[model samples]
Target chain A: MGLGKTDKQILAVILAAALALLAFQYFSGHRSQELVLEISRPGAERLRMPVSSLPQGEQGRWHVEGAAGGVYLSYWPDQGVHVDRATCPDQACVKMGFINKAGQSIVCVPNEIIIRLIALEDPAGQGEEELDGVLK
Target chain B: MTAIKGFRGVTKTYMKKAAFVFLCVALSGGLISCGGAERAKVPSFSSTRFLMDTVVTIRLQVIPGNQAGRLGAVAGGGQPAAVPAQEELEQLVLAAFNRMEEIAAKTNRHDPGQGSDLQRLAAQAGDGSWLEVSRDTLFIQEEVERLEQEAAAVLPAAAGLVDTSLGKLIDLWMGVRETKVLPRQEEIEAALALSGMEYIERDWAGGKMRLTLAGMGLDYGAVAKGYAVEEAGRILAQAGPAVYGIIDAGGNIKTIGQKPDGSPWQIGLTDPLKTKELLASIELAPGQVAATSGDYQRYEDIEGRRYHHILSPGEGWPVWYSHSVTAISSGGLKADYYSTLLFLLPAQDALELAESIPDLEAIWVTASGELFATSGIEDYIKWQDKSGYKLRD
Candidate 1:
């Protein structure tokens, strides 16, 4: 039993559409999403906002503020994240510059704010795990 | 006709088996994709708990892709063994910290009459008589005795500068944590007079140690934690050869192995003046132990003056030399002892003294805020903050 001419055309269309979907994903989607800035403050869950969602280099943005008052975090796609503004006395976290590496993190003990860079394979922000550590 | 149908049946069975195999391969691919590219490989794991009177953190690195499904000896193969490598490391690290706690219980001074060996020894030291010790206690006492000889040779203006003999001075200074009062100058002087390694006698053959001075006590403030950290590393190594772990008791950090990727571990050096800022990051190779002692942690602020815990042996007062000192040794005991010495030694003598010692790498940061490293550590340190003090090559 052989396929009819119409059946062959339908199968050809499905194969072409599947290949097109793969190409579209290859070029315009997925890979670029891996760079993310994760903000965590004491007594709250970690908020992993996309680097794109963060207003780039914009100081004093409410979007970056946290639970215990406000701790402003900033990040650029290539540069990484840092505490732009904080209420703490020393401002050591502000002085830490940026930690753009995959496992690097900027911690502010006074305000209990920690911003980490999670550079992973999935741009869609799935399967992200926090590095194991005790903050003293 | 019967033979032809039998052949057809065999052909159909083969086709079904082939389809099932293809489906299984597709499912495996899906599982790999679902796990994420990075997760499919062994990821670094960390855990933090309060141990040894401070926050103790442990980090274990990369379980290579090949070792992903395998569990370490501690976990065993009695259950669903698909536990990720990171999970395996976390469990093993917990075991290591438990070992540290057990050792701490045997030796810690703060827990006096808690049945710790230190408390028992302190009671025995009342009459300056020899007392037998457990194997763990003996190991720590031996290290303490060895450090006393090392410090006496190189450290300046010192007697209780780096030994358990300072137990008296430490007690006077630490006072009752609740009352939080500084001891009178005369009281400190009295404690200092009784402090010196010459007062202690050790008989390794008899497995006993004694304090010759009736009022003097022995403490391993600088040495015991390193021994504990190293012991923990030993336990992890026995469980898994590839386990790369670090036991960081405050500033004392010892690595069990190099990272799986074969790169050195990056350890941040805290700025002596700035309580929270990191002044630099140092890299350590496999089996290296690093420690940083600073004036920041334990200090008394009186009348707008800061008196750090590191006291000079000769002056009977806190030593005013460097704000902090960093030391890395091939082993934990040496690093802990030398780090304390670098902090107490005069700034002018520290750099040269650190260089004279073999198998020891040290960096001293003066109170005036200049960072100086011996030639051994010059290459390993990467300075982060350069405003107050420049990293002099």
Candidate 2:
């Protein structure tokens, strides 16, 4: 009634592989991913940067200059905001970024610049691809 | 062979039954006792009523017996004996009342600034040049003389009005007359200095001019409960690191330390109409103050028309809005004053003021059953019934 040796070996290997996968998922993988955005639009050109790459203390700000004008964008100490200053015809984008919602953008129509905030969890970015089999 | 097999099967069944019974007993006991953690002595907080005044009491969990001695030893002070406790508590309350009085005196406009009546008169009589004095100067001079006489008269009368120091504060508010001129001037100067009102001297008389308080009609009722709480805590804290302590002056309450089992204390805001009913319960940890002011506490029934005690500064009348306002802060005195002030101000303005302060929280229950509270309040405290009060951001 005992199982054959090869069959037992195969089952043991499968169990070991499952445990390894679980360990990998638990220890190193990120439980969450946060996106902090700073965007400044000057005339037609839009300047955007992720907070992760900037120096630790300077992550909440961005400076941009163009032929049309110069502007600065800074994050609010509370929640999210991107304040900008410019001499553009519309000056619309400067008033935007009070939020950084997924797929939302600060648009300066006259300047042809768009500062977008795309959530890292956005399904569209995956485009039907699997991300580490945890989420697709 | 058949008998042997039958005997083995019977034994197996009996063993299984015995195991099941043992398992059931173990599981039932575990469910009841919840495992070796001594049934958390539902550490209690009690309320005592004295002369229409209620004191909420919280008996905290600590290494019991002679805790005062241990605390005394740790703090390098002699153990405060049992007989002296009441006297000491009363003295602390009186001291705090004195400090409030000092603050009030500086804020009072009618007290001639440190000058004798004769000196003030001499300054006014200057070379008999009445025409040289400006109108504003003349008015101020007259105000000083009037205040001097009133101060002499009312100071003695104020001594007999209320039973407790708290009552004294209330009587001052009800009877005293004159804007908080001295305190206001000092506050303005402090505000300009950017040092904030807290850092300014507890007593700062503005312009050194003693303006008499109007008919001695100033009250510190709203602020006194907090003052009492702070005083009580000072005495208690001197004893040792108390896990939890609360002093509820009537409905106004202040809490410190964690609960007996080391959780936060849960405080219920009473429904103004149904005093027994709870509008909301808030969980607070150690070292915080919470004070409530309501229309129902001191309402007047004039021709069957009911009116509450909270009054507006400008019109000297009460403006109805929230049935009650409860403010939480680290300091009891500030929380006490602000709770009454918030009731007098608009909801939006009150919220703005609350936000300006760090570590401050509030719950406003309006006439419409709407509840307005700040964001930090939500995270720090848990609400029992989300139904009665609507949460305004």
Candidate 3:
């Protein structure tokens, strides 16, 4: 039963592959290999898109309709997400500039919209299914 | 004999099982301990907005220990639902800023298109007419009157320290900052004469504040912004005790609660003379505020000597007793009023005055490069420049 050399080789290869995947995840800073964009209107979720799937991160405006009104948002990979335009009287949201960091968001109260960048690598905010209530 | 050999072989397999279980236990135990550190990791959320004629930066955090095992519930119905705790904290801060906007709209004095209630009060004061304003304006006026009476009762020698009666003096000095032209001495003297509260009347029952002196103006510079900060704190306090953060409104700051790890909030004091330098710092527990008044910011050079904004009613000239004074109190408005009042007093008198008031402490930077503080201030203040003398008593 202990004589098979092929079994030993197979086990070693599997262990090496698992360790390599973990190392890549740690160094690259994203377990999922891509970033997810979570969009919500004030309190509720509106849409979620992968950063690469939406559009090329050119300096351009994107609009997403909400319950209150249309929320004008823009994304630049270099700068992050900001409110380009909105229906609100005070342009405070527009003035907030871009929020690119994980768990950071641009909240437009007038339009009741929140745009947050979720990094799978950021365990404090890891889960995409729900706004994490449990921190650990 | 064969059975005995089989048992030995089985014992060797059991030993392997025991070793593997011990290694698994060690690795998972390490993971749990590391994850415990992350639980203490309460992320800080900061937002900056230009409001009230200055940049207002608000930093807020949620105490993880307050979650009480309930983490994902939305704040309430009138607001959005299904919000995370971190976003909920940010939303609460934004709501506070919105309240500040209402305050700014009511108090703005420079807007000519649609005058704020404060501007209207001034216009009515000029024409000898009954001035009606909002409750917020009335509240500010009441606080000014109370402080005015307090100063007169305690420090008669420093009478007219701030000159609540000289609304005209405030306006004249404001012109100096904006236009960089010093007002003629005779004009300032005339305003200083009428700047006595003996000339004005307040009808608390009727919600009216009237000025009897003709050609006089009204300014709420000493206490307006701090009062707004206190009001904003009240808005957040209604949310819950879990709102732990700092609201730095220019130099005046109000801290809501302890930090994430339950440590007191530590604030760095900005150097009055040196730009981008910290002269000292102090720790503040929850529900405390610190307000620093420095004569360095608004000043004009006349010949060689510099003239600052805080002017004396008795001499109708800039007060040069101290470079800066920071006051600590429960409410921001109180701290702000005391800082301005202390800045006008001589350094020695300022320390004595701070000691007399209950729950009030002050740290003063004297004109002669000395740092002095009330007996209570020494316990909390972390002095950066020990070169300056400290009046520990």
Candidate 4:
């Protein structure tokens, strides 16, 4: 009734598989917030807006006039909001469009405008419409 | 003598097992920790079309472990093996483009019900039916002409007679019906057909709202790259145990499996203005896709104005908002397309659209280097300091 070759081999295979699965789960569990962008300017005003207050499903927006431009910032669930519009001939901020998701961005080079996408805390119990802009 | 031989053999066997067990237990901890270090494998392939003229390079990694047990070795349909996964990916993209062309034809083609003959005569004067009309695009055009004629006849007289509201509504309806810009895509059409919803109606499935007619045309160009990555991931996963792979189709990427030391896959985000530099670095785990689109990636300077390649379907021009946008999600295709679409839409509008899809997550970067992200985006993002981009959310 001693352990046989076949039994030992089976045990080895099973052990290997279990170890692999455990590793997979461990890796899956450890998550890091992807830093989509960083905004650093000398004297630019920063505005904080909720993801809900912004466009429901969109990420970011820019309003640029002749010499000024403002950018609205938000996240998927939070719809992080900001204003970076100023009057400038470049009006480059308006042309850049929205940057809602991580690793995406909208920059107004002329007005020194910068808006980025980043991770945020979820506001629970938010309506779908309010959260739509952040989500999209 | 026989008993002694048996005893010696047993002792040797037990010693071997003990050593193996010891080795297994010792390695278990490392193996467990190493599981998360999934590095993207760059499959060797050639470039096809460039994203904004920047050459799109593709790399595919095949999974070597359990994935093989699940998705490899079995051919679903009759396809050739000489075709690299990258080529397959390329084909998928081309197919989508072709589909778009088809939808465009359907939208602009003349419809006979629109009084084609008379409409053409009015527009062409005495040219008769000899106008340079594409046979494939005739029906829809005809329909548009008929609608236009009818609208013209009614609008002149009703310009001031009826309530402005009724007249405006009619004009809007006629305009849409006459000049159809939104083309029907296979995925959207398929989703609608499955849900039995009208173009204007919306329903929720897979935690995302299915809009019948999103008004925005569908192009898999953004999402298809991710889809190709996903397909490559499927192939790698089926390879065998200890198999690790990464699929990077253009900028869209998917990685599933740990590296030798068990670290997450690191991806560099490109700076819009400086193509040679990395704006930021992102780490991704297995079963995830990442995509980035930047205005600097493809742009044509016209009269000193820089125009990027990411164009809005209805606007017929590049979007004006953020310089770049990137989205990471479980599905490669979803992440790829969402990033591109996100760049064109308003911030709030993009978020709403993303929110409609349950599995989709996103992060946005503005022109001034400000950052924002969806709530779920935190689950997958890994940021690096010294990178000018900052997260908003």
lDDT by residue for model 2 over B1-393, one digit each (tens)?
A: 995455345544464454444444444422333234533222222111121122123222232235534543454556532322333433433443344333333223334574432234234332322223222233333333333343225243211121111212332333322332122334323323321112111112232222122112223344544555565566554424433344544455556444334346555555565543345556565777777778876655555444555654333344587788888877766566557666766666666766766667887878777776877786644333435556665
**Two-chain DockQ for each candidate model:** 0.04, 0.01, 0.04, 0.02
Each model's lDDT comes to 0.63, 0.44, 0.63, 0.43
Tens digit of lDDT per residue, candidate 1, span B156-203?
443345766778887777762335566778987898877777776677
Cα DockQ of the candidate 2 complex: 0.01
Candidate 4 chain B has its poorest 10 consecutive residues by lDDT at: B158-167
Report the C-alpha lDDT of model 2 over A1-136, residue by residue, as the tens digit. Answer: 3335764475456546545554554443342332424233331111122232221112323333333543444554334545456558667777664655656666655543445664333121212211110000
Native contacts kept (model 2): 0.00
DockQ of predicted model 3:
0.04
Candidate numbers, best lDDT first, in rank order: 3, 1, 2, 4
Candidate 3 structure quality by residue, lDDT tens digits, B1-393: 995455345544563454444444443422333234433544335554555555454656555654512322323423322323765666777788887878778777776766887667666664677776677777876787687667667677655575556677777877886787788999888778656766566676787777776666566677777888888888766545455666667657788754445455555555556523446556676778787777765677777777887878788888888888888888877888888889999888777778887778888888777876888867766555334445444
Worst-scoring 10-residue span by lDDT in model 3 chain B? B68-77
RMSD to truth, every model: 14.0, 26.3, 12.1, 19.9
Per-residue lDDT of candidate 3, residues A1-136 (tens digit) = 2414664465455456546654554454433223545655432212334353332232234445444465566666556777777777777778888877767787777666667876532221122211111000
| TM-score quality measure for candidate 2 | 0.43
> TM-score: which is higher, 1 or 2?
1
Q: Which residue runs does candidate 3 get wrong by more than 4 Å?
A: A1-136, B1-45, B65-91, B386-393
Question: Model 3 Cα RMSD, Å?
Answer: 12.1
Top TM-score hit: 3
Q: Which sections of candidate 1 miss by over 4 Å?
A: A1-136, B1-38, B41-46, B66-91, B126-128, B150-160, B176-182
